[model samples]
Target chain A: MTDVPPPASESQEIWRRRRGRNRALILVLAALAALFFAISIVKLAQHPDLFTISLDGPNPSAVQKAPAKP
Target chain B: MNTSFAETTVAGGGEQSPPSHSVAFANETELADWIALLKPRVMSLVVFTGLIGVLVAPGAINPVLAFTAVLCIAVGAGACGAINMWYDRDIDALMRRTRNRPIPAGRMPPGPALGFGITLAAASVLLMFIATNAVAAGVLALSIGFYVFVYTMWLKRRTPQNIVIGGAAGAFPAVIGWAAVTGSVAPLPLVLFAIVFFWTPAHFWSLALYANSDYAAAGVPMLPVVAGAKETRRQIMLYALILVPVSLVPWAMGFSGPVYGAAAAVLGAGFLVSTWRVLRDRQDAAGSSLTNDAPARAAFRYSIAYLFILFAALAVDRLVG
Candidate 1:
């Protein structure tokens, strides 16, 4: 049997709805991303020293000296 | 092509009936239906109260965080609304006020709405935790649970006091907001919660008074439907009287300045007068409204403005004081 395509009007209507749903999804995701990014920036700004990392030296208490001469 | 031709169309060599017109229309409104499920009107009040909570709290929150907290509260309240719609879809179809909702109108199925509510509920709580603190997130979660379990499932169908007890769910947003900033519930937020709690029965029952037939048709056991209009009016008056004192608690406790105190006094008096008119509205011997519930409708409208102006005054007092 040969395949039969949907009528043009029906196909267009379906596509319209799909497009709307997709557009809504995209907008929501973009908003969420922006919100998260803004939140991160604000949180980091609030406690700048808390998240800061010092590359100057390892903590002496946290470091293990090479086990003597093994 | 017409609906019949569309329905009988062959696709991929198989005889397939396309979706009906209503189904197609539902598909077209899919996004809008999802939003409608959130009950945006209710979310606005929740967001406003939550925002006030954040503003009035003791400590400073980054504006971004504050915004996030309010967004989470709004989303969480919306989630509750969606779930409430899902559970109440049966009765909703019976009531004129709710018959046109997405679910009852058959624009959306129940499963997706339930899923949407659950997903949003989880997301709001998790985001609240990340953006604010555990206390705020926990209260948000509790509010969701209470609305879904206690109010929607348990009390709403069972008792005339449904809104009375269920009102606590709506009261949570201010507490959640305060918790977001202070990392704890304080006296001010608690007072705000009490004010909203006491204010709810008067506000809701006023609406219920006019919507009595709708509630009766739906068998929801609302105050007017169960205890009759006279009792409902009395309850509305009692609650309004109690709300006046409760609203003044913020000023009495020194959490707010004289501006809020004066505003509360004036607003509370207006509220009392509104309820008094409702109580004395022209009615038949059976206690039904003789003039089509005009006073109740007016009271309902004034109650909304009362809360808005009252809270706005509190925020202004805090800002200026």
Candidate 2:
């Protein structure tokens, strides 16, 4: 009989492990995003102008104030 | 479920497929390869510059948020490093300096590396957006994209000016850091970005001078590989000459105090002297010295320290003032 060929893709173990790792990574990221969301909420409560998400325009927080007249 | 059975099944059924030879991290060195994928050494510089960026900005940040900002920058830098490693694996395998890297050495798979990179990149940017503001997150995302798409995929293999254009990716940290605090860009961070943009060639070319064969073997068209040693050396000095003065712009503009000014001037002169030595030393190409790269190696080491000291000086000046 001819020699058996190898698997083309990653083995089941590798895929399983990779999936597990990916899950863990996703979880950690989700937790971090959650923490950040909590922080943003707190920050927005305390400093509303500073912690904002924006699209299509400059963040209101970033606008530099003009110098006052002497 | 068994290993032998799985292997047998694959071998028996998968006639058209290549062998699935994936292995676990069998040792600490192999585990370290995963970390190496992150380019920790380079990440250190990114972290340092990013930290200084956050610190020296005029506005104050919540300590937790500041920590998060720095962590995001570090992870973001590592993410880019991983993506870079993943993309450059082919050339990395060819180069002596990178031949032993995880993907090239068969210690880690490319697919996972790519996943790791993209995930960290997305996570970092998202976290930055949530913890800080959109401006910082946007800049971080741009930096990662530029490094991956613009530098690694586009410029690196095609042209000698790759690093010059790719240098903008490295320069983004200062802006990211500053934006994390102020939630906006400013002149000081822009100048900081310029300093890094100019400094990159001098730093990388010195390493390339010593590692010329690696780049040449890999077909990477680095400045030293494409331009020849003399031209590369001249360019190194030219960039250093410009970098020194540009480094002082923060002080000149009054964003930083005199202490930083003095430190920048002194450190810059030293940087110039180091590059001058690199310019004068022909042996970097000749392989004549005991190290076979005395001048280039010295300059490469000094460049790292120079950046650290320069940014540290900036932070100190800000604190002292």
Candidate 3:
């Protein structure tokens, strides 16, 4: 069978240009994962002081003023 | 969706439909693109400001509810961001500064973006209803609608006033956080809203000034495109001037103590001085040097810190006072 012609449109051409960026994203993400887990493991093993979401609970001092009439 | 862009085919040789392609992508990056679509940087700022609102509200909120409120705000901000990325995909493709983003890069299709944004928008609102009061949830939903429909669809391409008005979406998290605790709005939150509202043009215009060429190349009508550099710098100065006193309003209204007021004064003075330095000099004697090299770059970066520090100071003052 004869090879089918590729589709031709401005949108398709633009889409083709984006393929490079997708590959770049993949490479970047792979590098990030290796770096991230390594750092995570090292930090957790060496220093347990790294992570805390929030220290104190709600602030105790915010005075409740009466709501203004709507 | 065709809604992704303000597309106009210019003097086309033939009428056409989108071409069929066999496969969209070859990797997991395409699937993970949805996360980038969330605009993580913007979400962080939304979370910070919303937390400040929870902290400054006259009524104290439980820590768990406050955390939930902040998370919902971030989600709502991210939802709008997804739709923004979707709608601006065409311009994002055209502009070099935006060219690397997921939608512009074509890793994720536009249909998925619209779906993801709307889904998150709905989920955030629902979660808000569960975690906080109905008023807070309603405000969160309205913020999403405003960002998607008003800012992205209607205003962005249509007018330069887009950011000025559309910055309301960013301001709503403060109201959402405040309402989560108190179930209503107040002067303090409104002051916070105005601070962000005014801050938008100044902060973004500095960017537009520096990136005027990218905006011009993309054919987007930013202030620098429409009004020219002289007018843009003048407007930046005016906004910073207005922000100085307005930033100090928290103290005047009694929500902030003297520490916040002092911080605002010093910070405001620094902003104005740096902006003046930017206004006075140029890269050369050519036509309006739009280059933001050192002092201007400092101003732009410090502007972000200025805001976060202001909000954080409010939190600190509350804790100490």
The alpha-carbon RMSD values of the candidates against the true structure, listed in the order shown, are: 5.4, 8.4, 11.6
Can you tell me which runs of candidate 2 are displaced by over 4 Å?
A1-70, B1-31, B282-291
Quote the positional error of residue B76 for candidate 3 in Å: 0.5
What tens-digit string does per-residue lDDT give for candidate 1 at A1-70? 4345556776677788788889999999999999999998988888776667668876554567888785
Question: lDDT tens string, model 1, B1-321?
Answer: 222222232111226544454345444555777899999999999999999999889879888899999999999999999999889987887899998787777666676788999999999999999999999999999999999999999999999999999999999999999999999998899899999999999999999999989999989999999999999999999999899999999999889999999999999999999999999999999998998999999999999999889999999999899
Q: Candidates sorted by DockQ, descending order?
A: 1, 2, 3
Q: How does residue B198 of candidate 3 score in lDDT?
A: 86
TM-score of chain A of each: 0.65, 0.53, 0.45
What DockQ does each listed candidate score?
Answer: 0.39, 0.09, 0.03
Candidate 3 residue lDDT tens string, B1-321: 321222212111224333233222211234346678898988988899999889888866656567778888998998998999888877887889888787666455566687879888998898778667899999999999999999888988878777888888888888889999899988988899999988888888777877888988877888878887767778878888899999999998887899898888898898888777667647554437645445556678878998998888888998788
lDDT (10s digit) by residue, model 2, range A14-55: 555566667766987797777767686668787766766688
Summarize candidate 2's per-residue lDDT along B197-275 as a digit string, tens digits: 9999999989888788889998889887787877888899999999999999999988899989999999998998899
TM-score for candidate 3, residues paired by index: 0.76
Per-residue lDDT value at A29 in model 3: 72
Candidate 2 whole-model C-alpha lDDT, 0 to 1 = 0.82
Better of 1 and 3 by lDDT: 1
The residue-level lDDT of candidate 2 at B142 comes to 95
Q: After superposition, how far is residue B250 of candidate 1 from its true place, in Å?
A: 0.9
